[model samples]
Target: MFTSAAMFFNGAEEAVEFQCPVQETGLTATIEELMSLLQEGNSNSNSGSPNSGSEGSNGRGVYSLDERKRRRMTSNRESARRSRWRKKRHLEDLTEEANRLKMENRELKNRLGLVAQKCYVTWRENERLESESLALWARLSDLNQVLVAMQTMRSQY
Candidate 1:
């Protein structure tokens, strides 16, 4: 009946190990579970035995009320500190991402402006070419008419 009690502190990979002398105790739990059980036992002992006050021993150890409260407060403070650090890191990540995106957007906008200018220049050139082509066609038509007139005069003579 080998029971393992693994207690992780602050999300660390290392665990606190505790060995029990009794083989059939069969107690496999974490530190949190042990703490909850102790608290429950403390409450029950206080309720059942009115003589047991804040400093009463619960056969395990002499964990006074003040000591338990202090430990709980310390744990809570550590948890809060870790939470704040995580939040700060998350905010920093978001800020960095926003700056990166802004830079990309600025670059894209500059590229779009350059492309629009090129398109405008090409459109102007196309219009100019079309106008020149129409003018050349008109000139060619006039030349053809003059040639026909000269041919008709020669035939009359």
Candidate 2:
């Protein structure tokens, strides 16, 4: 446990040393190393304060409870806004699709009506032709009966 604490101290000293005459990558690496050391520091009790890990020392890169909470809140708000915008865009796309489908449905209905009208006219023409055919067959049957009677009278004479 004391070894961990000592490591944390050395890591923090290196972070502060790198801050002056700052090399960007060196400072970032040292700070990241320090945070990892502190997180590995399992103290007996977490006092829920920023300085709790370092025995109340004001260390570099330590986040206070309020700052952490504020950051989390801002992050959550940004996520929520992005989600709402995505939903709104999806709904708009659905609405446009529905409108297109409705227009297509109307066009199909009009085509069906035209097909029905054509079918009715064709049926009427077929009925007229059938009636004319029946009338012609009846006249031919009467003529055949008259010819048979005339031949019988001539044979009797």
Candidate 3:
């Protein structure tokens, strides 16, 4: 029974060796090499032999389809997470830009309002000055007419 248990543990260790270990950065160099060998073997011989090259495979590679799928899923998840973060950042930037533009627009409008008010006040002052000038001219003309009349009366005498 002790020998049987030891044999079982050895089998488990061997099974672990037969499969590829998942790596964070895509596939490991060893797995990539094995996958290439497997592809080559498949292309060369479709003999459908039960045993070809390695212990579990037919002299090809130790590349497992499930392992490839799992790695792809992990990579895709990471890519999606990055994409979401980028989109969120972009939205935040746009929002900040919009707020800045709105503030600028409001400031410009205020400045325009102030300028318009100053222009109206200036126009009113100009109208008042024009009226005052016209009145002064009329008074001067009346005084000149009175002096002319007196001169003519003196000449007649």
Query: In terms of TM-score, how similar is model 1 to the real structure?
Result: 0.57
lDDT of 1 by residue, 1-157 (tens): 5543433221122233555333454343454467557555644444433232433334343344655688889999999999999999999999999999999999999999999999999999999999999999999999999999999999999
Model 3 segments beyond 4 Å from truth? 1-62
Which pairs of residues collide in candidate 3?
52-58, 52-59, 53-58, 53-59
In the range 71-153, model 3's lDDT, one tens digit per residue, is 78999999999999999999999999999999999999999999999999999999999999999999999999999999999
Residue by residue across 46-81, what tens digits does model 2's lDDT show?
A: 334534333244554445466567888999999999
Model 3 residue 85 CA deviation (Å) reads: 1.4
Greater lDDT among 1 and 2 belongs to: 1
Model 1, position 27, has a per-residue lDDT of 48
RMSD (Cα, Å) for all candidates, in order, is 12.7, 9.5, 13.2
The model with the greater TM-score, 1 or 2, is 1
Q: Pick out the ten consecutive residues of candidate 3 with the lowest summed lDDT.
A: 1-10
TM-score attained by model 3: 0.57
